[model samples]
Structure formats: structure tokens, C-alpha cells
Target: MTRIPELLAPAGDAAALDAAIRSGADAVYLGASLFSARSQAANFAAPQLGQAIDKAHLHGLSVYLALNTLIAQDEMETALQIAGRAAERGVDAIILQDAGLAAELHRYLPDLPLHASTQMTVTDRAGLNMAARLGFSRVILARELTIKEIEGVTAEAKRHHLETEVFVHGALCMSVSGQCLLSSLNGGRSGNRGACAQPCRLPWTLDAAQKDPFPWLSPCDQSLLDGIPDLTRIGVRSLKIEGRMRSADYVGQVVAVYREALDRLQDNNPLNRQERDRARERLLLAFNRGGRFSDRPISGQMGRAFLAGSYSGSYGLFLGTVLKSDPVTGVLTIRSDKASNRTVTRGDVLSVRMSGEDKERASAPVGKISQTSDGWRVQGFHPDVLRTITPGLQVYQMGSQ
Candidate 1:
């Protein structure tokens, strides 16, 4: 019998929690109002946390509270108190990055399951051994590990009676997991402490006189939906999707696709070519960088293609470039490229991108959409966005309602 791994989804808020459950996640991870890595996310407070846990438990979904930020000496006591509250609220587990806090929490609540965050940078046998010794029940392997490396680590993990979790999908950091100081150096915010300003997503240039800047530090988002079979075969206990800061629609869409894939895998019926292509399209519709997906660590590529310098941030399926715009009526005629298969309808979100620009010019929901002889005729944009519309600007579907 094949051991099916748990499908873990991110729950940044109540809406995301609902999406994760509705989309068929086995477990969901979220953070409290304090000491969470994603401080920008609308995290739950004490009362809200309890309610969220109850709601998830009702659906047979386990909730893991992310106290995964680096705890300073002065903040240790407060962090422990938060852990105690979460434990009392019946959280399935607590994810942590600080070894000191993990040790203290283990001592404080001996039975509470502790998961080592990917921020812990545990990639090899030695790291697994150390994690086991520190009383972590499971370890989230660093995102930098290849599939082969993951298999080796999982094999070693079983020897130490520790379950292993791998990030099957989501954004990939340019630096090593748990070791990035670039955000802190550039700004006062620290990635380790979870207040990352995402400075890497910003543009930079090697040449001082260069007109266009590139996002050299940002890598394409990882999608290992195709690699589920290999991960299951290697005895990975959990498959994680990383997007706590994304919208509920994105979470629901991504989770639904991965859930279907996992279900097929469990039943020994893998997705056919057409089904796989459709799934990839749905994932792309939810969110994508450079209008493509990549298993960067698995492929072991660090070149320009992998870096995706030209296209930064979450730009969904690339529809085409603007051929004409009517600023007064908020109508735009677009000439689509290779995205002929995708259809834009009412309520779908569209992002406008200018040539040689990293950031989006404008994003608006589609009020009306129609296929034209020349191209796509889209309308329902706000008056202000009309000014930004121009010929040759790229357009992408950020999400579909």
C-alpha cells in the first residue's frame, strides 16, 4: 500500500482557511497576530485563532500555528505564552524556526507536536539528526534541495523517527532558506523575523547607465504537481503549498488543482496529458511569474531563464499586448499572442504591463469581454486606469472570479 502524504495549504486568514478546507486540504498552516513570518498577512488574534481552529477541526482539517519567526531573548516569554494558548486551543501542531524556542516549547508542552520550519535550513542527515535531538516531530526540508536530495533526506529522516515535509509549490527565494539577510540589510525588516519587505522583487541593474532594471534576485514560482508520485514513493509525509499572502481565490484554485492531482495519484490514476495541461492552465490562471512555472531546485538551474529577471511579481496568464485604448470609455483592444486557448470573461482580473517595466501599470476587473476580429475588446476599467492604457502594453489575467 502506498502511503499518501498530507496535503498542506496556507491559511493566512479566515477566508483562506475556508478555501483550504473547501479545496480538500488535509491540513492548513497559519500564524497568530504576533511572531509570525508573514506579518503583512491578516493573521488571527487569540479569540479568532480559537474560532479558526474549531472551524477547521469541524472539517477534519488539522491547523498548525506558525510561530516560525526568530524569537529574541526578550520576546521568548511572550512567544511561549502564545504557544501555550495555541496548544490549549487544540492546534494540531506548532511550526517553529528558532531552536531555542523549540526547546523551550518542548519543555513547556511536552506532548505538543513541533514542526521545524523551512527557515531552519535543514537539508541533510546531520540537520535532521539535530532537529530530532531538538524534539521536532517533523522537519520542512529547505527549498533549495533537489528531488534526489529530498529522497535522501527523507530516507535519513525515517531512521530518526521524524516525518519530512517538502514545499511542492510556491515562490522560491534566491538565497538559501533561513539564511537571507538581504532584506534586513536593505531595510530594517528581517526575513528571519518574518517582516520581509521583499526587496528582492525590486529591480536592479549591473550597468549604471542601463535603462531597464532586472529582478535578478527573484526566481520563478515552483510547481511540483508533476513530481507528486516521486515524493509519495520516497515516503514524504506532507506536501506543502506556500502562499499565505495570496488571495482566497488563488489559495482555493491552487489547492483544488493539487488536491485533484493527489487524489488521482492515491488512486493509481495519474493525470493524462490533456488533464495535466488543463491543471497547469488553472494554476497559471490563479497566479504565475513570467507567465510560467518552474521546479527550480529540482532542475538545478540558476541562469537568466531561471531568474526570470524581465518579469517579476505575480503576473498571471499572458493574454497579449494592447493594440488600442479608449481612455474616455475605458475600452481596450488587445492583440493576444500564444494565449489563444484562454478566454477572458466578465469579473476576471487583468493586469497591464508596459514594455521594459517590472511593475504592473494597472490591474482591473473585466466588466465586459468580447472577441473581436482584430483582437480582444475588454472594458469595465476605472477612469483612472484608462490613462495608463496604451498601445503595445502587455496584459495578463491575474485571476478569474
Candidate 2:
């Protein structure tokens, strides 16, 4: 029997950690107060980091400390101290990006398990071997590699007794990991140091040749649920989900979906497309960047249309275009487009993204639902939004559902 790869989720905070554990994560990776790539997230402080590790251990889930940021010479001692603290708390592994820091860690704590971060730019079998040689037990592969590339690298890695993990789901960067200078040169915040400003997510106007503004850089979030079986067969050890800044609700929903998908893969029954479709629907409704999901780079078609530039921000799921509306009666008729069968319950929130500009014109919760002679009416467009809803606007559910 093929070994099932671990479902590794990100936990930005305590709540996110709880969600991952309860939603069925096999292991989780998180950052402490400092030396983390996602420094902007609500990272755990020293005390909180220890508490989180203990909490995760209580649930019988392993916690990997993310010391995965570029460390300066002066900060080396502080980083080591944090690593020492992480070791004291019994962290399963320490994910590191800096070679100097890894060397220091190896010198101080020779027995500690180290996993090279994706930020380390480990792409090929040689990079994997370097990590293994440097005393790293596992290596988180770079996100931009093709499936074929990953297969070759993993094969070589396992021969050297190195574990291989890859980002199976979550946000995709436009540039190569740790090599992006847009955030650093453009904003003084280095992505390699974990303080990325996410300038790529913002809309941009094309050069003078074409004066059109679009998010020409933003890549769609990754969803490898369907490819889990294939990847595991190829000797992948872990499937990572990348949303440390997400809400607990989002964390729980995504973890549950992937966990079930993994279970189905390990089962005797054949893969069910309909069941997977339903799971994806729930995933999209819960949280997604462009209101839709996409697979990783595939053969012959990998180069085309991976970017979600038209709308730079999260658009949830595209509900439909506005058929008609009345600002006076507080009712708007909309025929669902993306998923016609999708309905808006009382708790559900929706938004309409103005086409071509990457902006939201009208967004609010569904106050009431009614059917009339004219059409099916959705009530509760904010008072300010009614003036903007003229007609022919695309509707998408707001994320954090």
C-alpha cells in the first residue's frame, strides 16, 4: 500500500491552529513572534508559541516551527534562542531558509530535525541533496516546479533519505520564491525576510503601448486535491496548504475538504467526480481568491492563463449577473451564473465586482429572499450600494463564508 502523505496546514494564530487540528490536519507549521516569512500575520509571541506547541501536542498533532526567514548577522543569537525554545517545546521540526542559521542550529543542537523552507529556492535534486547534506531531514520544494520536475527531484531525494514536501494548495506567487525584489525594491519590505507588501496583488496599468490597468502578476491560488493520489504515488511525503493569514473559518473548511479528499484517495473505491465537485463547491463558497479555483501547471497548457490579473483581489464565488433590481422596494433579481443552483442563505454574504477595474461596487449580506411575478428577489443591498447597482454587474460571494 502506498503511504498517505501528511496534510500540513498553516496556523497564523491560536484560533487557526485549533481549526486545523479539529478539521483533521495531520501536522501543522506556524511562525513564532519573529524570524517568520509571514511577519505581518498575527504570529504567536514567545509564550504563545510554546502554548500553541503544547496545544497541538495535546491534540496528538505535530507542530513545525517556522524559523523560515532570512536572518541578519546581528539577529542570529535571537533566532537561535527561539529555535532553542521551539526545541524545548518539542517541535517536530524547524523549517529554516538561511544556511548560516542552519549551520548555527546544527552546531548548537546537532540532533534537531531541520526542513529547508521553500524560500530557500530548493528546486532540483542537487538542491535537495544540499539540504540533506546540511543536516536537514526534510526539504519543502519550491512552488514553481512542474509535476514532472517534482517527481524527479523527489525520487533523487528519497534515495538520499530526505523527506519531500510541497505546497498542495493556497496562494501562488508571481515570482520565484525568495527571489522576488518587487516587495523589497519597490516597498523596502523584503519578501525574503518575510515582510512582503504584496505589491503583485494590486492592479497595474500596462506600458504606454497599451494603457490598460490589470493585475498582470497575480497567480491564482493552488488546489492540488485532485492530484494527491498521483503525488503520493510519486513518493511525496507531505501535502502543504498555504494560508497562515486566513480566518479560522477558512482554515477549518479547507482542512476538512483536503482531509476528506486524502481519505478518499486511500480508500478502495474509485475516485468520485461528483463527490469531489461538491467538496470543491464547499471550498469555493468558504474561501477563494478569484471566486474560482485552479489546478497547478499541467502539460502542454501550463504556460497559458494561470494569472488572475483582471481582478486582483479575492472575489469569492461568481454568483451571477444582475437581471434586474429596485432601489425603492429593497429587492434585486439575479440569475446565478457560476453555479445556478447556488443559493444565498441568511448568513451568507455576497459582493459584485465591477468588471475590468478590480473593484467591488456593491457588497453586503442577504437580508431576505423572496420570489415575485417579476423574478426571484434577493433583499439587502446596502443603502449606499443601491445607487451603484444599475444592471449588468457580476455578483460574487464575499470570502470568509
Candidate 2 whole-model C-alpha lDDT, 0 to 1: 0.82
**Best-fitting candidate, scored by TM-score:** 2
Number of backbone collisions per candidate = 0, 1
Q: Per-residue lDDT tens digits of candidate 1, residues 1-401? A: 35589999999999999999999999999999999999899999999999999999999999999999999999999999999998998999999999999999999899999999999999898899889988999999998898899999999999999999999988878888856898999988899888998878888887889887777777778899888889999999999999999989889999999999988887888898889989998998888887788887876765666665566567687788898888877788888776456777889888898776767888888888899865688897787777778888888887765
lDDT, candidate 2, 1-401, per-residue tens: 34688999999998999999999999999998898989989999989999999999999898999998889999999999999988998999999999999999988999899999988878886797789778998999988777888898889898889989988778888888656899988889988888998888876777777776667777777787677777888989999999998888888999999988887777745358888787888877766666566676622146535776566556577777788778887777876664446656775777876665467877778889875444357888865567678688877766433
Off by over 4 Å in 1: 207-212, 321-331, 335-339, 354-363, 372-375, 382-393
Each candidate structure's TM-score, on Cα atoms with residue i matched to residue i, is 0.92, 0.93
Poorest stretch of ten by lDDT in candidate 1 = 304-313
Among the numbered candidates, top lDDT falls to 1
Clashing pairs in 2: 291-316
